[model samples]
Target chain A: MRSVTAENITETFIGYFGKDTDPRVKEIMASLAHHLHGFIKDTKLTHDEWRESLELLKWTGEITTPERNEFVLLSDVLGVSSLVDMINSNPAATSSSVLGPFHVTDAPPMALGADFKRHYEGEVILVEGYIKDTDGNVIPGASVDIWQTAPNGLYSSQDDEQDINSFHGVFTADENGYYSFTTIRPVSYTVPSDGPVGKILDATGRHPWRPSHLHYIVSAEGYRSLVTEVFPNDDPYLDQDTVFGVREDLVISYKPQAAGTFPKEGFELSGKVDSAFSKIDFDAILIKK
Target chain B: MRSVTAENITETFIGYFGKDTDPRVKEIMASLAHHLHGFIKDTKLTHDEWRESLELLKWTGEITTPERNEFVLLSDVLGVSSLVDMINSNPAATSSSVLGPFHVTDAPPMALGADFKRHYEGEVILVEGYIKDTDGNVIPGASVDIWQTAPNGLYSSQDDEQDINSFHGVFTADENGYYSFTTIRPVSYTVPSDGPVGKILDATGRHPWRPSHLHYIVSAEGYRSLVTEVFPNDDPYLDQDTVFGVREDLVISYKPQAAGTFPKEGFELSGKVDSAFSKIDFDAILIKK
Candidate 1:
């Protein structure tokens, strides 16, 4: 029998899949096998360690549900999601960010200047942004899908206290490429830490807080769709987002606005606040497909 | 907020766990983050690819159960288990091999020259081996744990048709440092190929056959335990073990013995007189702790 040593194992494995008809699959498997073997070799991984790693993976898998994907969370916390986003992102287009695990399809479509916070109770904020192309031309009829956690730091999907679709909406840019919505200012909150990924954070002493941000997936005809997030500059976790979703171009200041100074065209002030209202203006840029 | 690019994401992630109280966890997390990010960057992975990868991980995890561990099998098929074994193995001791997923604790102990195949229906074979130290001195009372698939190529644990503990036993070497057991000649078999690992193999056109071999875990007082396998030199799959568990020194020739030529000390001639028996002689060497 041929002796299979570490020195020859890699070649043997790669050879097994060398004849794969699918080039992409072949490429992926080869690279995966190579790096995986290299990591084990570099770490001089012990049998006990190997067992622990396998158990970790098993636990991670066991906790994954359609509503809560622990594997995606693992990829996020490991910064792999961000790396992949950066790699595939078009530099000339709006910078991309991590598409966190909370995005849901078929979000309720709302008219421009509508309120997404139907039952939310927090500091009200008005967000206005324009959808433009790299050439500075307005992209009319662009779709902007937005979602964020409630003030209590739990997403509408995760917290039963909030109404269905609270703090979530899909709006379209008008002729002027302008879209506006009224909602509560998002609060920085910890990522779900009750599962295996959370256990990893706790064991490593890594904080699980993600910066307060709004998730958006912007798209229009003939333009590349951009899935990203906009972060407030003042959040403590701005630089320490557990998922590393922050981008310089994606951060904007939430300027304080006097109660009467709120835009009358798209927003209605509901409360007399001393310092509880803010306004943020940002723009989304997309590249031609 | 700082723009999180591919280049900066790694540093940001490593910094999160830099203050980890456990240095080993810190080291492992940092290395894991680095390589994981490196792999993403090297592959220039696309968003679709990332999603597919995440989905693949989810499926791999979801399919895992107590009876079947897809992650460990993944490690095995990818040659990661073999590589880790090589890294941790003592070169001076008996060559180590993959501790396949079938080993179970609390195996029934038997006297020397016991028959492990209580209900087996195949060519009878006698396996005799000595337990020795690196210095070649006999290590009396050494424990030799052995397990293998039955003639139908299914391990006792996997095949319901076989009785519990069939083709499985733990024996002790005698004062002469010798151990013997009677079993049916092991037939080459395929690893379980109905899971995610098997799917990958099928997609890649790689066979899942492992060489016919007997699994052994040998240990004695004052010596480090050795976990390995012995393969019949003539097996066609010896060079193609799916898990890459074969080692040169672990392969032995099984001499065909006439019915009456078999050792009478522990075995009984129950079959015809032609060529219904085989004898294999091997030895196990352990390193001093």
Candidate 2:
């Protein structure tokens, strides 16, 4: 028996991976153990700290539900989700962001330029974006799935009174890859602060607010679909989003248009618009698979 | 906003720690983030892998209970616990090993050399050890808390039929730092193999068997408390203990003694002569705090 010591324990652990193990799994496991052991050794972690970490994880799991995956949120607050997003980013395409727990794959289909502001009280705003391939050609019939929080800064999934698709919709782009919808403008909101993720943020003296933004998953035939979000340049939390999900290229400007200047063609709010509103225009870019 | 790229995201994450954050916490969190992010980036972890990891943690949490701390077991199987043991080990004293999750503070007090063999059936063995200071002076009245699995390869905590103190006791050293007890010999056992930890070990083609051993938490009034374990040298799993907890210094041989040669003084089994039994003598060393 080669005496097991702190110095050789890492290698000894990796050595347990046998010939029958998958090469990739072995590689990942070895590296994970390497860094994990390194962190423990470097910190000289105390028994109290180690047990506390386990408690944190237990708390995270205990609070997790189908509606709120605390684990995903934990990964988000730790910047792990963003790091993974960045790892898989394509230089020629739009950068990806966190797929927060609120996304429901069954978002109802939306009509182009339609508004869904009847169920909530908030400032109505126009959000339009084009879906294009890496070569800059508009991808007709591309689908854009979008969802945002209500005026109260809670998603439909989070608000018991709201329908599953309250602010979520799947809209098809036109021949020019143009899609538009009017809804309550998304507001900067704090993440769930009553959970373990919140405890970590509190410990670090970090705020829990995410920047004002719209979640999007845009896809078309024969392209690597883009999973991203568009952040208004003026949002206070843009640079310091709680989940670190923002990218420079994904930041956009929201133009405050006078009531009379609101687009009259194909817009649901054309006839009812008697007040000023903001407009955000972004182009969703995808790489061909 | 300093645009966060794959390379700068780690720095941005650390920058979130404010002045009010504990300096040690910041250091640990920063190092954790550094290594965690590095692992993700270096491996180019896929979205599938990222989600799988969250699931793994969730499963681990789901299986944890007051009696079964799966997280601690997870740490043990990964060799983190052993590393911590070595980190805090004193060179002048006996080497420490993992304080496996089975220890409980309420072990019943035991006579110095009494046997607890009536509760179970297996090969009877004598485990005698001395507790001394670093200067090699025996420390009388040093309390030694001990526990071990039964012949069925289960600890009292793991076996429902066994009482809480079935194979557990707290024995005090004599004026010369000598302590001894007789009990059913422990058998090598596999850790819980139906949980996420098992899945990890299985994926790596690693066995889950730990070497047969006894757990100890020894302390003297004026010395540092030591939590360690001892293994028989002849055990097949000694070198590759599933938890990597074996230290050469803590391994001893269990010498077979004929019933006629068993010690009679201060021993419960002295009158009930048996056929054959094993005897192991070890001396535990401690460092004064």
Candidate 3:
């Protein structure tokens, strides 16, 4: 038999991708094909090299698990994951942050100013926040689900049987879009480094620490819901956050108030306790519904 | 625990990758870390969106096989595979081309000018080339291995029970760096698209067709070996090669000559049996020892 040119062969191979059946799928596949073809041409690849790549990928699949997603980590490490996020996220609303590896469904709901800190406390603090539209109107009855790492930089899920929801909480905003909770200060923490992501970090000379911040998913009727995080002003890693999640608009000052007197008028504590507490305030701006 | 400012957190993560051991692993890992962090930061990715990505990748892994390398195909579609190949291939010799899914090791070695048209025969062709230095000196005893698809664009290996190594052969160049073999013209063919690679192609509109070309792996003492293809000059899809392997230098015109006529004086072939034989002349330049 005779040998065929790579061009006709590739055309015949790619013919299997259906046309216009799904617009989104078509767009993505076309772009992917274009880039892939470009890459092949640019590099002048070989058959053995191609086969070796196939083997590596096959191994990647063999090693993946429900709890350990190597492929997602591959995409994440490749920047494709973030590129998708950038294209889909709303820039006007608070900047979105990485939905980390630990978002489990179903957390117990709590009332306003309630201490969801079931265990482990480093300081006594009163927290409050208002959910509002960009027009500055109150969004009453809004649900503000919050969570963060503990003072020791660990989450209950990160440690087996560590009952301290430590910094995890869910709060409802009042009629004025106001809510508050008490907890100890959270320190910046490292993400799991034992997997592929860790292997990658070690190879690239990068840090694994995510900056100290609070995760929030806020929702209310007649306003767009938001998923975001807020960074404190005093944390030294503010400017160089590892996950690149820090935003100037999202950073709030954590002020140190006296141990005994009412922390401050607009702040939420009524004749504060004997321990010093840090105060930070942030207003949530929703997009028009 | 209370959350700290983003700045301190950022620095900590950055330092982690920089201090890791194993330079090679460290380099790749840190690059992944830095870029991934950059992507998350640039996109401000949301947790739910990240979860969705993880699930998509998980599915990518679950459906791969030895016969069907979805991951390699994924890399191929993404251009990473080709890019890596280009970075590693010998740059000064014949241009390296993608090794499609059909090569099996241990092709039967045949004498010079031996015919490979046993199972399917429609035409008689003579493939002749020289193994030489860039300075035009012949390299004696160079090995040239050739393989291609059947007249119908099917490889013998993929045809099962057709006998292994049916259309593949290895030939030794004579003292003058001249090597000749007999084989038919290769027909353009389509690649397999029934797997994940196919699904991806379906999601994206693409055609896979390879133009007619001859695959060759040439090697000799004191020279870098080369794996490349000589494409047909008249292939209709040269410009649209799927694997991006079209190079002007690799395209050759085949001349049909009378079987028994001695067209050239210095060359011997005064009374060879032939109906119509196509002849090609090209030199393989070896890099310095």
Candidate 4:
């Protein structure tokens, strides 16, 4: 038996898994053990501190459910999720961002120019975008799945007042690779701060707000999928998004339009809008796998 | 708003807690964020991998109960607990070791030279020890808490077949700083490997055995407490204790005695013993706070 010591424990742990058949698993476990032990040594953590950390972790797990994933939130707020996202991003493709915990798998499909502003009381906005390949050529019939929080700053999954797919839709690009939708203007909102992650934010005196953004996962049959979000260039929290999900290229200006102006072809306003509408003319570029 | 990016997320997280009133919390949080992001970057973790990690963490939390702490076990298996223990050890005092998750607050108190072998059926052993200050002066009236697994390799807390305090006892040092006890010889045992930690061990092809050892927490008024364990020098698993709880100075040899030989002045055997008994003489040195 090897007499285990603090100085040798890291090597011992890594050695124990040295025979892992999967190279990826071995690499990940080794790095994890190294960093984990390094952190403890750097901090000289005490029993009380260790106990508190365990308790915090337990609470983070306890607060997580199918609809709410506190661990992802924890990873996000700690910058881990964003770091991973950045690490795995393909330079040849659109920049990737944190795939937050709120994505719904079965978003309602809609026509290219359909409006998702059912019973919404906020300013209506037209979001038009093109799906193109890196060669600047259009990829027609690409799937554009998008979701955002309601004006009240709550995701449809988080609020019972909204329909299951409120402010969310899946649209297929037309033959010209164009897709458009009308929905409530995105507003800056705070990430869920009512759980263990929230406790950390409050303790650190950090704001939990994420800038107004629209999530998108665009895919075409022959191209690599892009999972990213578009941030409003003027949102106050753009610099300090709680989940660090913003990317420079993903930030775009939301052009202001007069209340009665129609930006897209064959589009009509369904509600009596008296306020100016925001129009975002964003385009996505996908890489061929 | 500053567009968040992978390059700046770590600094952003650290800055969020820069104004923490408590310097320790700030330091710990900053270091945690740094190492966490570093690990993610090193691994280039994928979205699927991130989701798997979250699920594993959730299962780890779900399996934890008041009696069983999977998080602590996670720490122990990863060498984190032992690292923390070594970091906090006082050089002048007895070396500290991992406080395995089996300690109980309500251990039964016993007089000096009492037997803890209630209904135990294994080779008998005599454990005698002294508690002293760094100056070699005897420290009387010190509380010595000890616990160990039964010969069957199961702690009283982990096994329902044994009574709550079987193989566990608390004793007060005599006027001469002497303490003695009788119990069955401890056998090497495996750490619990039925949860998330077990999954890792299995995947890594690592055995979960911890060498035969006796847990002890000795403390006196006006003196710093010592939380440690004594390992049998000859135990086959001494070098590879699963929790890395072993210290060089804590390992001692157990001398063989004829079945009828009595080693101490006030020692008495409570049950019939036709087999040889092992005797260990060990001493503990504590530091004054």
Residue B88, model 2: lDDT of 82
Show model 2 residue runs off by greater than 4 Å.
A272-275, B271-276
- Per-residue lDDT for B21-73 in model 2, tens only? 99888988998998899899878899989999989988887888878778888
Docking class of 3: incorrect
Tell me how far the alpha carbon of residue A191 in candidate 1 is from the true structure, in angstroms, after superposition: 1.1
**Model 2: how large is the Cα RMSD against the reference?**
1.6
- Model 3 residue runs over 4 Å out of place are A1-64, A70-92, A121-125, A150-158, A162-170, A256-279, B1-93, B105-124, B150-169, B195-200, B254-283
Best by DockQ: 2
lDDT of 3 by residue, B1-289 (tens): 2221232332334354455466544443344334444444544455564566456556666766544445655565444544544455554655555555566578998887676776466565667778987777889999888888888777876676566687888888999998876677888876666655555555556566667888888889888777677887888867555455555567888888677653334333333546666777767777656
Worst 10-residue stretch by lDDT in candidate 3 chain B?
A: B1-10
lDDT of 4 at B196: 92
The deviation in Å at residue A283 for candidate 2 is 0.8
C-alpha displacement of B34 in model 1, angstroms?
1.8
lDDT of 4 by residue, A1-289 (tens): 4666668888887766645447888888888988888889888888889889988998887788878888888988888888877887776667888778778888989887787776677867788989999888999999999998888888888899987878788999999899988887778888889999988888888888888888999999989888899987888888778888888889988888777565446564554555577889889999888
- Candidate 2 lDDT by residue in tens digits, A138-242: 999999999888888888888997888888889999999999988877899999989998889999999999998899999999998788888888888887888
How well does candidate 4 score on lDDT at residue A169? 85
lDDT against the true structure, per candidate, is 0.84, 0.86, 0.62, 0.83
Off by over 4 Å in 4: A18-21, A271-275, B18-20, B263-265, B270-275
